[model samples]
Every structure is written in structure tokens, then in C-alpha cells.
Target: MGVPRAFPHLKMRQRPVNISNFKGSTIALDVMGYVVKGHYRMMKTSGLADDNTLPDSTPGVISSVEDIVRTIVAAGCVVYLVADGKKLPKKAKEHAARAKKRENDLVMAESCFQLGLKKEAKKYLARSTVISPATVDSLKGIAAKFPGKCFYFGALFEADSQLGYLAQNNLCDLVISHDSDMLLFGCPKVLFTMNTKGWGFYYEAVDIPTALGWKKYSYEKFLKMMILAKCDYVKNIAGIGIARAQKIIESSPDLSITSILKTVTTLFPDSGIPDDYATEFDEAYFTYLYSAIVDPMKMESTRISPPPLDLTEEYLSFAGYVHSREQTLDIVLGNIYLDSGRPSRNVTDPSNLDELFPPECFFNSMYEHKKEVLEFDVDGWEGPSPNEDDDEDDERPKKFDCVECDKTFDCLSRLLYQTVTHTNLKAFSCHLCKRTFGYRQTLELHMRIHGGVRKSKCDICGLTFTRQDILTNHMAAHNEARPFQCDQCPKTFKTNSCLHQHKEVHLQVRRYQCENCDLSFKRIRELESHKSTVHYKARPFKCDKCEKDFTRKDYLEQHCLAIHTSERPFVCEICNKTFNDSAGLRKHAAVHSEAKPFRCDICPNMTYKRSDHLTRHMKDTHPAKLEEFMAKKKKAKRPPATSTEEPKKKKPLESTSKANIKIHKLSPQLAKLVGQSMMSQIDIVNKINDIVEEKQLYDPNNHLYAFGDQDLVNVLGVLRFKIANVFNLLNRHLE
Candidate 1:
């Protein structure tokens, strides 16, 4: 259930105490453990009876429950019974595994029975014990008989968490449960194995960390240790038992699972750790720390019934067990109360239990409170009582004021909301704009404005809006959508502002007029922008690098790229040259290609690379033909106004340019041979062969021209110089 053998190792120093020691104290009872123990006791005495005859076990079970309750009540202590709820979500796999184990145990028990090992068979059969639904119903009926004494949580809640909550909140002086996990749940004090005899060991929450020799280990560290030891959710690491786990946890610099795993792998090289061990550990850790449980306030709301001395017939009948009145009374009243020779009191009897055993008596009985108080002398000293100003304070109305905004509210909650809204204590903030909002929903709405995220789409026109309300308003535009009508005209518009603008056209009104110029606009923002840029020459947007400014922020960004930055993002595949923009690269590509799609209509042979070049040629050569060509171009480009058409697509760039041909430079000797030949200026290669043959300078073995003398070297030098000049001219034309 928790860390195995963790209780004995972490138990506080305890001594034997009698039932009278806990008089007038409030104790929380773990009802599930007592019920299970009682059932087991009944089964042992009745030789493990079948389901049909199990009702006979109810008296013994009821006897056990009453024994524990009466012992605590006889000592003048209050008992609040807490029962476990339905199976926990985190324990689902464990529950299934347990069921499988029970099945195997049943098989083993049957095998043992056939082997004539009756003792071994019974042990195996006991291992398969399960609490039936009928037993649970019977227990619930018994609890109903004593109203306000029991609490049942939701189906998926844990009883230990409720017990811890009650103890931690001071609702109970100590929790009485067999579960050691209550220590991890932060119960300040817990009494374990508390039975009718009142002989049990109690552990204080502080004793755990102290016994573990932890300097800074918190509740979380303790939980991590429990998880490492293989709790209900997590599997144990092979070769890493409780002792090794404690060492690993204590020696680890970081308590995180990742850090712990790293240290474990280093320490135990032979132990093979699973790859998904960290993930499993995380799941277990979160389940233990954050799984839902019964609220402490809800536990407090449950009624507490005074201890019952006599048994009720309704409870006896519901139990379905045939027992005599004397036997039922004995079962309801434990040996501690009955054997003490005290007469049982009826429910109708007048008695003040609080007066009989006060809380001060219990405090005095504790061993820790055995020391006597030392008296100090005080001469002529008087102090005001805590309730001295209560009369004056009660007359005034309660008010809460925000410290930051200096605003007063009727309630503390309102003041807290206003304070957080005004202060920078907001949870949500925008990274781009550096703006903050008090609520996440408000921040989400603001993000939509920045991102232009229009998720709500209109079915009619496919227009979208960031908000549902705006989308709903836009839906009206599909059919009889235009409700705002102009009085002067029959035309209608979707919005009142649109109708007002249309009416202005009839009235010939220009609401926005420039102060410096005669320019007028329907909107004031446009007029202000024009006046600032053209009249005042004001540039609000400035570049960070060059200190240059522009009226528009977009223009300032463009200026930064074009002037300050030498970033050539566009490349010409034809020439392998880079340009600042795609437009520059397109114009540069025209030099390498011969295809000119734009042609003159007047002259069939005359063509231009670009449409603008064709227009320029037409205007320069023949002005009359230019207008006709432009009219034809416009007619060809025009589409029907009713058609929702897309813009013309750009031509895909060629991967490899056909005009890219490599040229080689002539060697000095080859240049010399060409210069000496008569056809050197025309057919250079043929001229070089003739010159080599005439001069007898051709090597027959290598088929190469050889320079024989100093005269040849001088002639070759002059030829090389003239060849270089000619090559330069050819290179210029290629470029």
C-alpha cells in the first residue's frame, strides 16, 4: 500500500498507554482497516463460511467495530469514523493485478486441498479473501443506525487523505489508522494498530524527517522516496530496494526523477534501468501529489453522533443475522466497557459527556505534559484583555481597501480583484507587445487582434471573424442583410456607418479636410497622415541603423534593407549573379536570353525583352500605332467584372541557362603561331597549324608547336599582347 517496512523504520518513540490516557480527545478512526480485521477474525472463528452463511459473521464484525468505538468513547474521547471510497483511479491497474493474483491463489488453494495439505490450503484460500458488496451494504446499514458518526467519500476518493486533512486542520487531535501513507499525506499525528485494548504506537509527522537524517528534505522528498520504492502506480527499479533507494535519494544533489535516475545509473552500473522509468516515476509522483480526495471542509460538515451503549433492532435486522438480545448488547458494547462493570446508558438518558471528561484532563495525562510550571514574580503589572476593544470594533462596518490603488470595497474579494488588476501580478502576458492582462480569456482576445486569427467563418461569403458575436453580425449580410437605409436614396447598406457614408455622397460632404492643402478625405486618419507626410514633412518611423526616417513603418523597414543592409536574397540562375530584390534579378536575366515575347505590331521583326521596352519602342518609332497596340493589350487582358478571378501567375525560373557557355584563353605559344600565319586574324586554329608547319616548329611526337629561338620568344610576346586585347573585347561582349 505504501513503502514496505517504512512504518517500523520511521515510527516515533512510543510507550504503552491505557485507554484512560486519551480521555476528552478527538480521534479519527480508519473504519476500513477495522472492518477488514473484523471480517478476518469472524472468518477464522467460523472456518471461512460461504457467502449464503456469511450473515453469521456480521455479529463478530459488529462486535469488533463496537469494541474499538466503545473503548475510545469509554475513555471520554470522540470518534469520527472514515471509510474508504470506491477504487482510486491511480490504483486501477493494481486492482486488476490483485484480482488476477486472487484467481491464482484460488487455484493454488484447490491444489493444496487435493494434496491433503489442509493447513496450506486454508492459508492460500485466505490470501484470496475479498470484501463482498453485501458486507459493504450491511456495514452502511450499521453506520446509518449511528447517524453523524460516519463519513463516506465519493467513489474515487481516498480515506487516508481525508484523515490527514482532518488531523492537519486540527479537527482531530490524532488520526487512528493502519496506513503508513498518512505520514506522507502530512498528518501531524497518527495512531497505528489502535484496538479495543488501547495499546498502540503513534508517530508524529516531524519524527519521519528527523529519523531519516534529512537536513532539508521536505514532504515532496519523502514522497519521491516512496515512489522509488515502488508504490501502487510505479514499478520498483530492479536491484534498487528500500535501503538502496533511501541511499540514492539522500545522496542525490537534485531530487528530480531525472537527476535521481542519473545518480542511480552511476551508482548501480549492474542494475539495468528501463528507458521509460523517468516517465513512469513522473506519473506516479503527480498521482500521489495531486489526485483528487475528499475535501476537509466536507468531512467537517458530517454529523457526529454520541456513542451508542445499547444495540438497535433495526441494525440487527438489516445485518440479517439471528442473534439474541443479550448477545447483540455484548456485540454493541466491547469488553472494555462491559468488563469494566459500568452500566450502559440509553440514548434517552440525560448526560453531559463534556463535563464528565474535559480536554484538560487528557492533556494532563500525556507523558509530554508531565513537567510542572515554574512561577515568576510580577509586581504591579496589568495588561488589557484581548476582548477589551471588541465592543468598539463591532460597532463599525467591515471594509477592505486595496493598498496599491487606494480604493475601498465592501468585501475583501472585490478589493483583491481590483488590486491584482491594477498591479503587475497578472498571470497572462503578451511576449510580442509586452502587454499584460489580469485574466487568461482577456489575454486570448487580445492575442487574436495581433495574430489576426479569424476562426469563426461565415458560410455565405467565407469571411471570418476573431469573435463569435462579430461572425453572427456578419451572417446578416448574406440575404436581406442590409437593414440601414439612406432616406434620400433607395439603396441600403449592412452597417449604419456605411449608410452614413453613402448619404454623405448625396450631400457632397467631405468631413476630413487638410489644413495645409486643398485635399479632402472621407476619413480623418488619411487626411492627418497626408498632412504629416506632405505638408509638415514629418517622419515618425525611423531606422535604427542609418538614422533615416519615413512617415510609414513599412517604408522604414524597406529603407533599412535597401540602404543599410547588403542582403541579396534574390539570385539570377542565368548569370549566377545576386540582386537585392526579385525585380532587379528579373531585369538582369534578360541580358543572357534571346527570347523576346514582347513584339512590335507595326514591325514584325522588331521585338523587346520586356512589355515596358515594347511600349517605349512603339512610342519612339510610331506614336499612332502605340495607342492601337495599348488598346489591343487592354482588351486582351480584361476579364468579365462578374467573375471572381485570380491574378496572372509568374513564369517559373529556368534551372540552368542555355546561354551559359564556357570560353578558354589562348596560350602564349599558340598566340605566336596564329600571329605569324596569314589567316591568323580570321581562322585562328588553322592559322596556328600553318605557322607551326612553315616554321618547322611542330613536334611530330607530341603534335605540339615548339618555340625554337629567342626571335620566336620575342614574336610570341608581341602576339600574346595583341591576343589579350582581342580576348578582352570578346569578354566584354559576353558580359
Candidate 2:
């Protein structure tokens, strides 16, 4: 059995006397969200210019262990950074080079691979501890990396796990992060947990309430109320938060979460959470923030429904933005998959499809569309204010530029470059949310999103959403035509979100990231959704057979099947096995090279592509690879290769500007491509003919078309005989 928790919620459990046992220790921050927020705040606070900053400077401070270490040293603490060292040497080199890294990226990521028994890890074990995610099958993986080798590290975490050990054993002083909910997990202390910036940044422990005088409750009560609010959020309630929950509790000082839980259990069936409810909460929180949240309004809102989305028509009626919410989601998913052609969305097939996309619901594709991706601008105001139309009437002039970027723009947006500038304003405000913004135009936009107003309405059904694309999609249900079909399942939606959400039914995964620090989540939207709704956020590494994203790129490529892809075009002189991905092929061939031959730059890594990828791999994965390789070899030289890989063209997305926005919004180019690639035009026409013919038999009164075109009807006398003759021929062929 596992060790039990202190049940921190139980009253009279005075701060454990040994709490200081966690003091003065070091913690690793994901540094992604914070980094981005920091940069945004800096740019907003100080209008920057080219000479003052670097281009792509938004991934705020603390990109590397080196940076963290510097901060730690300044604070007078002994610290060590936990890293996926297998890829370190490569990644450091990439940071040195300003190569193709993303503009808003926190730091370059280097893929960690399982290599044979590592000698360095064993040596490091004697001095410092190291940890990896808890999901790696190290016994099998280690054996493969070093058939006869053994390794020892001071400490080692698994491939995708962090908690069972970290929790039972106190590893540090406090967990610090933007999300303060970690206190519920029995974390000792947390700081820099507020949403404010810079000078406003402050630290708080579990006992913050006592520190700041509360009328009826203590600090623990304060923590409990906030945690309750987070727990309630996991259930889809929109207006619940720390303040609201606090106010509720303060109004009834005698009420505690224990009582609330009891009432909920008695009243709300299934509130008797299953044993692993904690894990569920963590997954939900992580997904809500990292993957996709269920919002009919926001950019990362959960997906649902058919198209010409029900919300699209309504939004276009008033909202001026030409793109609809569903379209935005399509673009985001397109970016992630890097598919130039939009994959056909078949959302009409799911049984519970209505759970997400109700007629009046809205949502967006979040994983890909960040503020940086959209490049939106914010306006600034000074004194009483000066109108944009009356710019000449202003006494003070505004100025700014991005230091690291190539171009400069006004501080009006705080962003460097953008395709559109904000001019029309809205005065939309939500009484429930109590948040106000710049323009009437902005207010109108917000109102549409928050249900204050409806911007999109389906022409076919009059269903609405804050976004227009959804309404257009809703109209597709009345289309009388369903074209897109899934290769894996019978499930389909009129739109992609509906279809994909149904697909989640077959997936099996539970990836966990400690919200206590900074880290990146490819599925942040889902994480946020989970956090906003779940109770105790437990840690679990997910292994879904099919996933929109994975903890590691290679995990799902070959189904994580024991036998990897044999994209082995490069046959080993020693073996004749084939391979699929070039990287796998190279990994298999590594045994044959005697010259320590597969050096990527200065790092001890393998290579698949020629110089560009190799150089990139060195710079991004192993900073030490290139220099070490040069020093070990005495000179940088290449092995003679008689054969090489053919240059492959990266398929870029073709803009669907003139795409048919009719009832069925299928792109003409995609339709043609699908006809040519998946099936022939003749095949499509034949399939349609078969459906038409089948329908004709059921409804004898309907006009029959001999040709495929709906407009070309068969003249009864001549076509009747022709249909019989063609079908007769078809029967003979079938026979």
C-alpha cells in the first residue's frame, strides 16, 4: 500500500512541526508561461525599441538552468536544475545559434533519447542527483542503450512522472507558480503565485489568510475556500473563483469545505468521487490550461457541432471580423499538424456530440493560437485621454520598438508587428465578470464571447455563438450532404472539433506536470479545463494509442510498439532490417560505425539528415557535441558518403481564401486533391450515383438523374432503358 496524505483539510492539523524540513531547497520552474507573461509585461510597462531589446524577446526571463542558477547564486542558495540531460548538449548549442527557433519559445527543446547504459550518469550519481520524467521503460531502455552497462545517478525520476516520490519525500522548501492551487495537494509553500507583475510580484504560503487579517476565517480557511472554488470550476461553473467562494464562506462563517463536500455528496450524485478522483482533477486542470477548455467563446474553447457553423452567421451579422471562430480553430489545428490542406471535419457522427457543441455554443482551437500567433495589439491611454481621430490635439507623443525584431511598431498594441490595427472600439462589459475594456467594439466582441450578446447565428437554425464560424458550421447539418468520413472509426462531426472530441473516447492517457513551477504543456488548454474543475490534482503520465499530441514525439509515431518504424533506407552492412523514419534507421545503424562516426556537431549524438539538421541538432540538443567532436577528432571532418538523402519539400499550407463558403464550406482545392489522392473523380461520381440510385428506389416520385450532376435529370424514356443496360453491365462485371 502507498503512504497516506496528511489530509490537510482536517481541522486542528497544526502546520506540521517538520515543515521546515522542506526549507532552503531548490525547485525547477517550467519558465514558459511565466517567461511569456514576463516579456509581455516588460514590453507593456516599458515601451521598447529595436536598440533596447532582442527580436523574439517575449519568452521572458529564466530560459535555462544557467539563468536559474545565476538567480539562485544571487539569493545565496545551493541549487541544481533538473533537466532531460540526454538532449542537453544538443539544445545548448541551438540556443547559441539564432536558427529556426520559435519567436515566443521559452527555450529550444532537445529530444531526449534512450541511449545504451550511460557512464556519465553513473559518475554523476556520486555527486549530484538527476531526475527524468517517470514514464520511461528504463530497464528495457537502459539495457538496449548499454547491453552490458550499468548506471547510477544520485536520483532518477521516470519518463513522465514526478509525484509518488516527491510528495511522500519532502524535496524542497516551497513550490512556486502562477496557479496557487498546489496548496491543495499538500505542497508546503508557494510564492510568486499572484497574477500581478514586477514590483507587484509577492510570495504567499498556505497561511496567507492569517497574515492578511480576515474577518471571520483564518488562513487555512482562506486556502480551503479558494481550493473549493478551483474544485467547483472543474465542474463547469463559470463565475466561481477565490473571491466569490470567499465571500460565500464569509457570509456563512460556520460553513466549511467538509460540510460543503458532505452536502454535495448527499445532493449531487457522483460527487462521491472515485478513488482516483485526484488524478482526474490534475488531468482536467492540465488539459484546461494546456490542451483545450470547454468555452463557446474563447480562442481555445472546446470543439463541438456541424457547419456552416450555427454561430458563424450570427457573428458575421454584427461582428466585422471576416474569419469565424470555427475557422480560427481550423487554422490552429492546421498549424499544429502542419497540414497545408484542412482535413475534412465530420462532426455529425458522435452520440454525445451535443455535450460540447450546443446550438448556441462557441469555442476556438487553443493549443496553436497564442496571442503571439494572433499578434493582437493593445491601446494605451494618458491623462484624460486623446482621441485617435484627434491625434494632432494630443500634447504627448507615444513611441516604442522591438529591440530583437527586424521591424518596429507603435506601443498602441504593445506587440511589435501585426496584420491589423485596432481602430473600431466596443463598450461591452459583463456584470458577472466585472471586467471592462477599451472600446465599444471590444465590449461588443467580449459580449459575444461571454454570452452578453450573440454575434453569430446559423442561417439554417438561428442557433448562435459569440464566434461566427461556429454558426456557419451549424448550418451544415441541414446540408443534406455528408462527405467527410474517418478512417479509424464510424464517428464523424460536421466540423473537426466534434469528430476529434468523439475520438478521445478511444484514447488512454494521464500526463502530469507539477503546476508548482514553470513548464510547457502542449495540451495546456485541457490542463486548464481540468484544473478549473478538478479536486486534488494528482500526477499521471498518459499513453493514449491515438493522441492529438504526445509527451514525446516518438511515443505515438509507431504506436509506441516495441518494434519501431523500419524506415531503414540505409541498409547496415552488418544487418538487412528495413526502417521507416530516418532517425530510427540511423539509430539501428549506429552499431556498425566504428569511428565514433555518428557525431552531431560537438555532441555525442546520431544524425539522419545532412549538415543543416545535424548542425541544428547540435545547437539545440547538445551544446557540448560540436566542440567535443572537434577536439576529439583534432579537426572537423566528414566521412565520405557515396549515397545521400533526396531533398524533400516541406508542404506549406495553401491559403483557402476563395474557398467555397457555401453550406458545405469544403475547399475546392481540397475536394479536388481528395478526389485525386484518396479516390478518383470517377469513383466519387459513382459513389454519389449509387447513393442517388438507392434513394430513388425508396422514393419513386423523385426525379432521377442519369448523369452525376444534380442538374442533369434523366429523360424517362431513354434513361430508363440506359440505366438497365449500365446496371446490367455492372452486374456482369460484379459476377
Which prediction has the highest lDDT against the true structure? Answer: 1
Tens digits of per-residue lDDT for model 2, 40-93: 433333432333322233232223223333444344332222111122111233
Model 2 bad stretches (over 4 Å): 1-65, 74-76, 80-168, 176-179, 182-184, 193-206, 211-224, 227-236, 239-241, 251-735
| lDDT, candidate 1, 358-429, per-residue tens | 343221122132133222122232333212312222323377555556678885336545755565355455
Candidate 2 residue 665 Cα shift, in angstroms, is: 19
lDDT of each: 0.55, 0.33
List ranges where model 1 is wrong by over 4 Å: 12-14, 48-58, 140-156, 296-735
Clashes of each: 1, 133
At residue 571, candidate 2 shows an lDDT of 53
Query: How displaced is residue 450 in candidate 1, in Å?
Result: 53
Candidate with top TM-score is: 1
Estimate candidate 1's alpha-carbon lDDT, on a 0 to 1 scale.
Answer: 0.55
**Global CA lDDT computed for model 2:** 0.33
